[model samples]
Target: MFGLFKRRPKTPGVARLEPLGVDVTVPVNQSVLQAALEAGVDFPHSCKVGTCMACRSRLVEGKVKAIRDFSYVLSAEELKAGYILACQAKLAPGDRIVLEVDIDSQRPHFPQLTCDGRITAQTALTHDIVELRVAVDQPLQYAAGQYATLRPAHIERAREYSFAAAPTPGGDNELRFFIRKTPGGQFTGWLFEQSRVGETLELTGPGGDFWLRAAEAPLVFVAGGSGLAPVLSVLEDAARAGVARDAVFLFGARTQQDLYQVDAIEAIAGRWAAQFRFVPVLSHEPADSDWTGARGLVTDYLAAPHVPDLAASHAYLCGPPPMIDAALAVLAAAGVADGHVHYDKFLDASNLAG
Candidate 1:
């Protein structure tokens, strides 16, 4: 429907998906993601519109044609990185292609321990995102800024997601996640439509080295969409530890409708009002709205006249690749040492790629 994909092959072809170890025939009429679903081999995917790149896979072998703008999600830099959006690619008829679901799985130090959990609650945080609370059977001992891999009960392939909150006061039986429901995505579509409380989901890990470093310097946090998950985790944990150093959190969204959990964030930030700042930026808001907040890309806010000094602080960013890249450029220009900044860029299959 997006008209972003080229004509698919009329004949079926073989595709071997790694990690999940699924080898299925992809019908020429259907996308690779669809084929996986048909075979009951749930694969990582978001917008089947070919916009989100949630179904991104690495071509280990074979040939194909992928039509993408390279300006949206898929880009020349990503192509060079050996990743292709499966939803946008047309497989050569009768040919076989081998692919790996994720690149990080190849890393030795990465621990991907599968854990079990049951949905305790699912709340609509906004028109697009939902806040899911899962009670795990076992504690997921991890750093505040780390993430995990999530696989819905019906999904065969697991997607990565970050922790939205720090561990509970007494134990780690419960975990939280803020998820965006991408249109045309099977997993999120079911999540927003048919999923129910008590639904069990398989979880894995305490992945990523992006956790908070020692709170020695001031901090700047930049987030986009559910990227707020891990940043909020770090902040909440810091607040509990009474480690309120001067900090600023700048969140960006396309419009007011895209923003969520504002009141909850404001409430938590109230504890450190003297040292913590929360600024939400809307890039495309209607002029008629009564909203009178910062308007533009978050990077613009970092460069604004009244912004505080960032050169002496540590910066943490979690969001789409484009926003992360832009924020890095802005921070560097503001004299924030490259080593002083930490970030978790969401180019993984976990993203709701619309």
Candidate 2:
């Protein structure tokens, strides 16, 4: 080996900050938030997982790289305006930036920790859908419409499920999840066949930034399969808060048997019938059955005459990517503002592997 000069720590990745006029340097490989924290600057962060855009800031001078995986939610114009998520961005040397501290301070914090929980109850909502109730060792506070990662002990695999249960009054320790069996999914197979009451499992909490925000706009919920989880959570949370805004939930399935939680939706509608409506859409039901509700694709229902004023309503969608794509187009065509349409696409890696 040839003798060579050693590399210096100040070579490149170090961030040279010019915060509010004061200049300083930070190490490379650290996110903007981490750099701020190390520099004694307070920055707001939640889910530190790059999913929440709460830590967004402006990249005034140098380039920054995103640290975590994320799907872009901001438009091209926003990026052109220098807005970038600090949690996902790594600053390079010579980067001069001004932090939007007010926006960052509003993000809610979620602790990252693994805990053990026991399966208290499990039930089949439909032929292939299962509802699980677990009691964790400690209380976990999470916003409705978020999700958790479930990993069985000694198992190398994990699954993500949305929270369907409403947050207990004053918050509680029990966690609820709604899971649908994907044809041959590894975790789903194990869950369907071997998961039983009293079985212990490991889970990571309160993931996802898809929770509801405070707004007076009317809301529409569209979902299919277990995508109904987060949608149901939003609706229940809204009803619990006594929100009087008009809301409609359009749940779709292949046939009558594929539908789950109809009664649950009906119950919520009955309680908030004055401002809420539940419509079940069947895509491939038998003609013999006397179905009086909406029929055909869920997108069709959204295009119907009874749809609320799109300009003042917010739309929430959760389902397969194809359905979400179509729903977005339909909503846009119906005059819904692009910024008001929020969605979470359920893409299973196992499905891709097959």
Candidate 3:
């Protein structure tokens, strides 16, 4: 075989995002995410400031470094596993590098649009959570469980929140979100402490791949805390579509006080009695306590006796990363198809500020 010309480094560098199968140029001054987006690489992203973990990717082969750490969203083990926030990592100028983009989930192609939205109402859902209803200037085209990014005035980076109600996928202009106040986070702190209704936020995107997919099997939804947002949205969507598929929702909380929107959910379950069931689980309440219902981790309900023929079900998971991680194990043990199980792992802002 004839020898090819000796390989040499070029003046500029390139990167590859796989699974999606895309290649793009990377500049020393710009992050890999910025370069990839300019080159049209489709991936999940929110809080472009590197806190959301939406643009997380693993370094497969080449050299890239992060300007800021995302320890809150990614555990130390994951960091060692080659995960890097694409929005924060960049290649050295004139350096050769290869990258393995870690995109574990998929979403339908929807052009992300940035628009103006006004808060129509802000009602407390729990001691620390609020239901923020917004009316966008123009209708957003999104699936029931998708999320939108809000760029609050005082915050430099945008925050991602999943829709809590299902408006028409391509027709509705109103957006609902369940927001929990993070103790020391940027956006949440500002929203809880200083923000008000009748205010405007720059909304962008309808990101995420956590919506309910078409499946013949029954739907089992496991949600914790504010993670109920997308679950509720999807359930409403299913009801609106007149889907007769059986659905069981297991909502977990530390105590009964943490649970919200019970009447609303119960109403839906009652109206769709033949097809829907709602079960609220408490993790901290004792057997002697006043609450009488399912208790313990949300996964407890999936254990053998409670559910029969779990293998024939499609499971949807949403909540904090810890809950999502644990539920994944149970779902796996239950024999749900990898493709039939969809999830959205929530991450809170932690130690991102200077």
Winner by lDDT: 3
Query: Lowest-lDDT window of 10 residues in candidate 2?
Result: 99-108
lDDT ranking, high to low: 3, 1, 2
* Per-residue lDDT of model 3, residues 249-313, tens digit only: 88999888899999878877876635676889999976788898888888888754455557888
Better of 1 and 2 by TM-score: 2
Candidate 3 matches the true fold with a TM-score of 0.76
- Which window of ten consecutive residues has the lowest lDDT sum in model 1? 103-112
Model 3 residue pairs with clashes: none
Q: Which pairs of residues collide in model 1?
A: 52-353
Stretches of candidate 2 off by over 4 Å are 1-57, 65-74, 84-113, 349-354
Better of 2 and 3 by lDDT: 3
Encode model 1's per-residue lDDT on 105-165: one tens digit a residue. Answer: 3222323356788989999877777898988887767667777777787776676678898
- Ordered by TM-score, highest first, the candidates read 2, 3, 1
Model 1 ranges with Cα > 4 A deviation: 1-112, 169-171, 304-306, 348-354
| Cα lDDT listed for each candidate | 0.74, 0.72, 0.77
Model 1 gets an lDDT of 0.74
Residue 91 of model 3, lDDT score = 79
Candidate 2 total steric clashes: 0
- TM-score, prediction 2: 0.78
Candidate 1: count the clashes. Answer: 1
User: Number of the top candidate by TM-score?
Assistant: 2
